[model samples]
Target: MRAFVFPGQGSQAVGMGVAIADASAAAREVFQEVDEALGQNLSRLMADGPADELTLTQNAQPAIMANAIATLRMLEKDGGVRLAAKADYVAGHSLGEYTALCAAGTFDLPTTARLLRLRGQAMQAAVPVGEGAMAALLGVDRDRAETIAGAAVDSILAERGPPLVCTVANDNDPGQVVISGHRAAIERAVALAKEMGAKRALLLPVSAPFHCPLMIDAATAMEAALLDTDLSAPLVPLFCNVDAVAIADPGAIRVALVAQVTGIVRWRESVLAMQAAGVTQVVEFGGKVLAPMVKRTAPDLAAISIVSPAEVEAFAKTL
Candidate 1:
């Protein structure tokens, strides 16, 4: 079986969807729709960038979604591929969840775009700048990383006051885990993790402390936005990031999405679950980032990254 996946924040680049948009009218329409929905020339920023502006949370969120959706449209219009017919399941990393839901037909493109815009804004506003920070703990398994995080929390509580909040933000793989919380605490964690045998611990250049309690405000905002929006049952099941489970019910998916704002992205577990479900091939739309992660996490699975019309055509041959 085949599983289609979308990429998250760091996958975005200047001129992301331009190739596909230029090659197919269907792809162009996706970009145009996103531009209109957001009431900005996001397409312009995406096509021509100073790089810094497009990398912001608000811009990167919807821009990445637009690129992925445009790639999907290119596969459909130019490569004669139909999502419902070609794929058995869909999934995405972090913010890419919204893009996956849209591709699976749970929500329209406009609603997805608007929802992502609000999500970005809410997440960005969740914590004050420089107060919270995230770091990647490399070459350590999840259990060890969790233990390190716990120790870091203890250290912080001993040094500061009670109510320490450091935690694992992402269990990416056996070799990579991300931790988030207070800046000083995270730095302490990085030092402690190295002592605990982690190969390296490096800070991430993110604007907010995502996937932590610090993002409770973002989660609350998402809950309100989700409640007001309409969600139809998806045509394909989604391997949710929060639960690492295949979810078909729109209501359940909505709840998971809201929780995911403050929940660790179980990307490693999600890919494992997909593998266990007999997904032999994984197709990553638009970006090449997730493909490498999939290969690293599950080397047995065949993975493809499609970013242009020619790549879409190549993928269609497999279908």
Candidate 2:
């Protein structure tokens, strides 16, 4: 079986989909649609970037999704590959979950783009700048990271009035863990993680501390937006980031979507579950970032990263 996966925030770069966009009119149409949806020339920013502006949360969210979807469109129109016929399941990491759902026919492209824009904005607004921060604890498993975060929480509580919230934001893989919370708490956790034998603890450049209880306000914002939006059952099952399971029910998906605002993104477990479910091949759309993660987590699975027109044509040959 085959699983199609979408990449998240860190995968985006300047001039992301320019090759595909220039090569195929169908790909250009995808960019055009996203431009119309957000009422901005996101395509221009994506193609020619000052790099700083494109990296902003609001712009990066939809820009990454547009690139992924545009690449998929190229595969379909130019390479004669159809997702409905070729892919058995689809999954994505973090914000990429929305991109996966869009590819699976759950939410339309415009709705997905707008929702992500709102999501990015809401998340950024949840905490004041510098008040919250996220750090990556490298070379440590989730359990160890959790323990470190707990210790940080204890220290913060002893020093301050209440227990300062700190938690594992993402269990990216066996050796890659991300922790999120207040700036002081996260720094405390980083120091503790290094003492606990973590190889490295580095701060992330993200605008918000995502996937932690500190994002409750962002969750509330997402709840309002999601309730008002139209969501249909995806054509393919989505390996949700929260549960690490394939969810197809629209209502259940909605519930998970809301919970994901502050829930741990179980990306490692999700990929393992896909492997257990007989997914021997994994195709990553638009960017190559997820392909390396899959390689580390599931070395036996055949992983392909489709970005340029040539890669799309090559992928079509297998189908």
lDDT of 1 by residue, 1-319 (tens): 9999999888878878888888889999999999999999999999999698998899999999999999998888877878999899999999889999999999999999999999999999999898899999999988998899899888878877775678888888769999988787788898898889899999999888889999999999999999999999989999999999999998999899999998999999999999999998999998988887889999999998999889987877877
**If scored against the real structure, what TM-score would every candidate get?**
0.98, 0.97
Per-model lDDT: 0.91, 0.91
What lDDT does model 1 reach?
Answer: 0.91
Give the Cα error of residue 24 in candidate 2, in Å: 1.1
Taking all chains together, the TM-score of candidate 1 against the true structure is: 0.98
Clashing residue pairs in all predictions, respectively, total 0, 0
Runs with alpha carbons beyond 4 Å of true place in candidate 2: none
Task: List the lowest-lDDT window of 10 residues for candidate 2.
Answer: 156-165
